[model samples]
Target chain A: MVETGLKLCLKQDHPIKLDINLRCQNNEILALVGPSGGGKSTVLRAIAGLYPIQQGYISCQQELWLDTVNTINRPTHQRAVGLVFQNYALFPHCSAQENVAMSLGHLPKNKRLQQAIILLEKVHLKGLEQRYPRQLSGGQQQRVAVARALAREPKILLLDEPFSAVDQVTRRRLYKELIQLRDSLAMPIILVTHDLDEANLLADRLCLLYHGVSLQSGTPMEVVTSPATAQVAKLMNQQNIFVGKIVAHQPKKNISLLSWHDRLIEVGYQSGYDLGERLCWMIPETDVILHRRYQVSKGERENPFSGIIIDYMLLGGYVSVLIEIDKKRKMKLTMSVPLHVARRNGLKKGIVITVTLLTKGIHLMPFESLR
Target chain B: MDWESLLLSIKLSTLTVIFLLPVGIILGRYLAYRQFYGKSLLQALLAIPLVLPPTVLGYYLLVFLGQSSSLGRGLEALFGQTLVFSFEGLVIASIIFNLPFAIQPMQRAFESIPREIREAGACCGLSPIKVLLKIELPLAWTGIISAMVMTFAHTLGEFGVVLMVGGNIPGETRTIAIAIYDRVQAFDNQAAATMSAFLLIFSVIAISFTYLVTERHKKYYG
Candidate 1:
């Protein structure tokens, strides 16, 4: 297991302060997901000892890697950490075999070469061991970099935007290879990436970071379904977010009523929110049910609202529908329906359709929760 | 034509390059990778030799290493000879005169290497010294060769500094440039013309070799 708590003050035109704490168990992939300049890469660098933090304690498998309070900061080479840079960073002058052998410093010269060849074969670059970095394809170079990182027998693996440089097809193949590699090793791995879908597909847990702060961290489903704040919901691609006021609270029935832009919406009850309190709420596009206005029975519909379809787009397999509820104000909400469902319901622009905002999908947060 | 002067010039240039290459690499690497107070001042000081008249530098060296100075007197007491008007003084002047030619190209070469490559080496558990020898120096081979060739070529044709310090001692400090001047002053136009052509051809060959090697390496590596 690896645990870290770090604080740093970055020196920039406008300095950014970062404070984060996280842990990863053995054989788990903890992905740090965020947008540009969010300090995801900086966290990875700090763990690898490339970037020093002013105050922190980083330990791996009961061994202390860094403890600023105790003044114990091991040099990068002395720490058992492996980092794979975004550009692979293979020695341009060394061949694939020699590059891997560079990490096998504990072995004799001949044994180092032999072990390097073994690692190359494991990464499926056996016959191309003599090729330089320039001669290898992007995927091939990435595999070589991984093999070299593993050659050091590190206790933790840190990958910084590993697959962003490769093509989609190659990235998929590498994902499969990475899963296999992870299965064989018991060490904790931390991956830094900006691609949300990639993180959802690969990581066992996800940490959402913004402006050098980790907003929330949990399993992919928890972070995506129940965001802690409105900013996090937006980062998770929730398009239907707006401010609303608590109009009524029926505690006995376990439901609350919120006033949102001339509409009264019933939502699940949340504690600690008083009547007349302003809150931010979000609904995922997938939970916005689209139905033909004529077929929906009034008694069966829950929180059903009618709006004119202002625009519609057919995105390959699904159709993205944008509806304008208040035409004068141009208040819009977007939803996505499968192409077959859209065609069956005759969904199109300029037509009034009914969409139900699912009660369970309504996530509310305090107005000041973002900070 | 004195063949001994030609041989002496080759020997001097060779020795100067041998001693200058290591010093150049150390200073060049340090200047390329470090930042400190007075760094710009130090760089400017190193570059003065490149712009100053060779005789001015030679005059400074003459005063600093002459018998009257403490350093020269100490050396004279130890070695039984003054530094001025000796082969050792000519070598000292050549090293200072050709320093910028040797170091600037090397510094540029060392700086051209990406930081990621060095960090990656360190991450791979290689020490800083090993990284410099195994990774940085090999990658900077072109710059090193350029520095060596330029320094050697520059030393081969040194005239003003050698004349001031060594005073045109035949077979000792009379390099090709000095010999050409001496032949011209004695009205031996044919010998002077021959030596000038030889120097020109030698410089052209050195520069052509540099270009050819660098081009071939670029193509092969790139």
Candidate 2:
């Protein structure tokens, strides 16, 4: 069991206080996803011993890394942890092979270079030994950074957005290599990224942080389907956030009936609820179906939400539609169906549309202010 | 106006430069990395020698390190030496006079480096000493060298501190400035001209070397 609770304080103009209490299971990649400057990187830095913590303790595998009361603050070099920087930060002065050899401590002078070569090969950076950082491409530098970190043989690795500097194609390939690396190693790696897709595909457990607080943390599906608050839902890019309350609830059932403002919006949920209790309905964008008329669903099992299209973004691979509800609220839905669905149905702004929330994708989460 | 005294002054300055280079670099690195409550106070203290009257500093050192004091007695007991009226005393006086000239630039050099680079080294599990030896020192070379050159020039050209501590002992404490003053006092204009010529040549070489090194660094960084 791995448990760590830390209060992170950064030295900006005002100290950013992030309290992270997490029990990350062994061998799980816990991805902390959040908005920019939300202290996602702070938590990673604190755990990695790159940032100072003000209060609480960090323990991994029953071994303490930090304890304020005990005053056990092990410096980074002695902590035996691996850290991959955001920019990769491969030494500009050193060659790729030498970069990895730096962490292979106290090895015989001649044997160190050979050992670094083996580690470089593991990262697929073959034959790039003599190449300096400036000579390597963004993707190759990232590989070198990972290889150098792996040379330390750390029990836990911390990566801070390793792919943000690369192009889309390179990022996809690096992500693949990272997954392969994880499978072959048993050490738990904590990754921080803003990409929802990356978080879902790469994480065994997803930790969503917002405004310097861990708002919600659970399995990727749990956080994705039921974000703890409206801010997290927004971070997840949920299609619709309805200001509603529990209209009817079955005591034995986990899900309860909800009404959005005045209209009834049926959703399938598995959380306790009290009737007349105020809450928010989170409907997935993929679950929203765009239609010309309200009869798109044949049966009454359909829960249609009436709204006007506020925006229609025709991205090359997908379409993002923002619907204005009752001329007051907004809903952003993403769809990637055939073009004929919108063209044949004449989907346009100021036009009424009936959308069904794939009930399995719909979730009613309680609302609370984090600030 | 004696030629030998002026040449001897040049000798003392050259020796002074040789001793202060390593000392200044280490002190600069320490001041940059150490974070204590009195850091600012210490910095001001390090810089005071540069701004204070050279005679005042010499007078203070003379009393504290004189033969009558415990420190002077302890030094004599350990090494059988005294600082008064000795070449060693001149070296010590020059080092103190030009210390800020050597350290201020080096401290600024270390300061301009991005903290992330050192942190990156630390995160890579490099020891603090390794970080200093491998990353910090290499990055701060330009400043360190410039500081060395400035210290060398200042020590070579020192007048007031050497005047207070040095009693113009022929071939011992009589530096080029003292030689020039003695010649002028005796109305020996021609000897003064020759000594001035020697000082002029040394100044040109030192100043030109400083300019050349600085230009190369500018081009390299640009």
Candidate 3:
């Protein structure tokens, strides 16, 4: 089988600086994850040829879409791109069927309506073909938008926060639909989203973007569990990132002792760091285990510490507990545990609890302050 | 009622609308979307006739299209007739004087459409022309209709510019408004009253229709 993909390298200075390089193979979905004003949508627009970039090279499926160096930029209409706008952008005056049919100009005029109905039906909008955009619910309008985008039979599909406008329930359903839709698609799909969980759920790979820069691109787990930099860790919502000094390296035990808040903590041996080197480290919430008050767990013997619970919030089936680990420095660690376990242990604010931070879960990086 | 002048008024208004539709659409969409160096200045210039006295616009048109000017001579040479005091010249004057009336509403209508919608049209592989025809024009029809109606009504009611530029050549240039003035000058109260009432009713109908469409558009879009 032939390998097909999209390769894009973009650089700009004024009017929102951007330095990004991305690649996505056919049959793969890559999510550009970032906050607003992070140039995620701008990247999508550039891919669709709806926005201009100062210097870039975009090639997809063995065709050159944009090459600023050679001045070979294709016009938006000339590019085979199917983009679902963040707002859906359906034609307000056109019926749902008409909106999809309008994009099928390549087909025979008599066959367009039939094709539009088939496409709409594929998106689960079967009986509401005659309704205009204003008459459809947000979820239904989004389905119509998806149907219209697919009507073009484009070379690449771009989704700009397609699920943001819908309710949470609808978003979950849409996520499932997209995951199923990905199986039938043979082209690269780029999805721009600000929600990390949505990206992790729907995308095959995640590209963390910040201020127009491509920070990291990898599998969702790779980026989440082992971020390349301290900033990437922070962007991944790692709440226990703390500054620590490497005090001693015990090659015999394969562990490095870190001096954190006047305590020597054993972590996985890191061969690249010098002694007394200041570094940043993070422990994922799932790696923090609360020691049972009555039962002694085997893992509780590793890196055990006592902390006063400062605050906690119940989020669905999980309780996010904030514990102040260092009294004078006011250092805090956020741990998420099952609601039932929290309730079983009577976990609440102002309670002193002992928790174990797994040694293997401690990920270290060069210390740098986030701007 | 001066039936000949009344018919001529309708003819002039219809011709003005027919010519102004394409112009209004192009200029309105352009003004609504593009940001050039002199965009605000151009917009202010387009709006000048709206606030300027009709007689002043008429005076400028007279000089610009009169026999003494080079453009007037070129136009005369091209068409084999001078533009001044002619029906053709009246159409030009009406289009110019009604620029704001024809363009403002349509520009606003085009502006009300979100930018993403146009970009989506392109992303769907519709060319720029198709986007304009299939997406933009359909969305902006109400505003375009309102502009046409306002232009037609305003042309029928215009007196000072018509008198200054076209000079009331009875069948050719004497519109209903000019005939009403002519009737009053001749002390014919019945004809003057009849024509005045006809114009008042027509203006009311045109304005009411425009308002109705505008309100419905607002309600639907909101």
Best candidate according to TM-score: 3
Name the regions of candidate 1 deviating beyond 4 angstroms: A1-16, A292-300, A313-316, A368-371, B74-80
| Number of the top-ranking candidate, with lDDT as the measure | 3
The CAPRI-style docking tier of model 3 reads: medium
Which sections of candidate 3 miss by over 4 Å? A1-3
A-chain TM-score per prediction? 0.90, 0.86, 0.97
User: In candidate 1, how many Å is residue A93 off?
Assistant: 1.0
Docking class of 1: medium
The stretch of ten residues in a row with the least summed lDDT in candidate 1 chain A is A5-14
Give the higher-TM-score candidate: 2 or 3.
Answer: 3
Clashing pairs in 2: B1-B183
Model 3 global lDDT (CA atoms, 0 to 1):
0.91
Global lDDT of each model? Answer: 0.85, 0.75, 0.91
For model 1, the local distance difference test gives 0.85
Q: Which sequence of candidate numbers ranks them by lDDT, best first?
A: 3, 1, 2
lDDT tens per residue, model 2, A70-153 = 888888777666788888867665789988888887577789899999989888888889998878899999999998888888
TM-score of each: 0.92, 0.85, 0.97
Q: Write the per-residue lDDT of candidate 1 for residues B132-160, one digit (tens) a residue.
A: 98899998889899899989988888888
